[model samples]
Target: MSLRYKSAEESRVVISELMLPSHSNFSGKIHGGYVLSLLDQIAFACASKHSRAYCVTASVDTVDFLNPIEVGELVTMRASINYVGRTSMVVGIRVEAENIQTGIVKHCNSSYFTMVARDDEGKGIEVDGLLLENTTEIKRFLKAVKRIEMKRKRREEFDREDFVPEDYLSDLENYKVKVTCTDEL
Candidate 1:
């Protein structure tokens, strides 16, 4: 079959219910981390659609929470492939939570993620060179490109630091990657 979505087109995934609670925080808003996990899942869907290959989240850039999501809101996650490299693909995912009952829509978060599509041997695979379909898609791609550039710059700035982040310093336990040999294939 042909590819799922055009390069310059917006591929959206809607989440009807993501466990919204009536009252959680003092402000009665859903937790930020909960929303972040949902974004990761939707971004995975976008990457898988583009490459038709299993992918893993390599890195998640800055996530700016512009607004809050109340209970009983329908969180619609719109994601699209923005940039492609040798083995890594960057997807732009915008998550908006709307109150279906009150018809209120608000932007929750906008973030970019890097995904690596791998073959059965757990190696990166080659993805098609997709073409943009319109100006809006092109605009999104450009914005993601800029964000990636900034990521590189920020990495360089932190290169000289000896302190390692807590997550990085933690032991790599239970993070085994499944790999299969060609002979077994």
Candidate 2:
């Protein structure tokens, strides 16, 4: 079978919603969970559009809330395929909030979601590769590749059979926790 390639622009998704009081937390700011839900929705849409198959979120790599979103601001989220594997794609999402009256926009959060396409039988299916058009798209794809590699290395190193907790004790010296298992050690 021939390998299929899709451009990043073909799978891009953008959504805007007005933040309401219902979406706010006790402190009156828009809740982080609400923002995360929007991010997931856009990620799924972008991944599904790229693969033309049902996609499921396998992992969320990073969700850094850089700025607080106000209830009255309009929140816009943009998602596009950053990288694609045989059966999975990494969707990068950027969230920004705009004050309608002031015409000012603030970047609120950025996240990366790993989504895997599945067939009707619920089996993983191969997805189309990304066709990077510009330097920015190329850089995003490379960054996703590096993130995946680093995550794999971290898991392998931490889950090794010969892992020793004591060896990492000194690394936590500046942390707030106090180790109290001296007798057990």
Candidate 3:
């Protein structure tokens, strides 16, 4: 079978919602959970558009809340396919909040969601490859590749049978934690 290809633009999705008082936290700022739910929804839409199959979020890589969003502001989320593997696509999402009266915008957060395409039988299926048209698209794809490699390395090193916690104890010396183990080596 011939391999299908799709441009990054074809999978882009944008959504805007007005933050309400009901979505606010005790501090009167918009709840982070509500924003995260919107991000996941947009990621799903973009992934499904590109893959043309049912997609599920495999993991959420990075969710850095840069700024606090206030209630009554309009929140906008933009999502696009950053990188594509056989059956997985990394969807990058950028969130911004705008004050309707002041016409000022602030970047709220940025995140990456890894989604896997599945067939009707609930089996993983191959999806279309990405056709990068510009330098920005290429850069995003490379960044996603680097993130995946780093994650794999971390998992391999920490999830091994030969892993020793004492070896990493010195690495945490600058942290705010006290190690209290009764058993001796």
lDDT per model vs. reference: 0.73, 0.95, 0.96
Estimate the TM-score of every prediction: 0.74, 0.96, 0.97
Pairs clashing in candidate 1?
Answer: 8-133
Query: Model 2: per-residue lDDT, tens digit, 1-185?
Result: 89989999999999999999999999999999989888999999999999999999999999999999999999999999999999999999999999999999999999999999999999999999889999999999999999999999999989997788788899889999888876445
RMSD of 2: 1.3
How many backbone clashes are present in model 3? 0
Which one wins on TM-score? 3
Give the Cα error of residue 139 in candidate 2, in Å: 1.1
Which is better, 1 or 2, measured by lDDT?
A: 2
lDDT of 1 by residue, 1-185 (tens): 44333463534444545446743466678888787787789778888877778989999976888888777788787777887776777877777877887787888888888888999999998765557777876786677689888888877856755644443423544577443424322
Model 3, 79-143: lDDT tens digits are 99999999999999999999999999999999999999999998999999999999999999999
Q: How would you order the candidates by TM-score, starting with the best?
A: 3, 2, 1
TM-score of model number 2: 0.96
Q: What TM-score does model 1 achieve against the real structure?
A: 0.74
Error of 1 at 72 (Å): 1.4
RMSD of each: 11.7, 1.3, 1.0
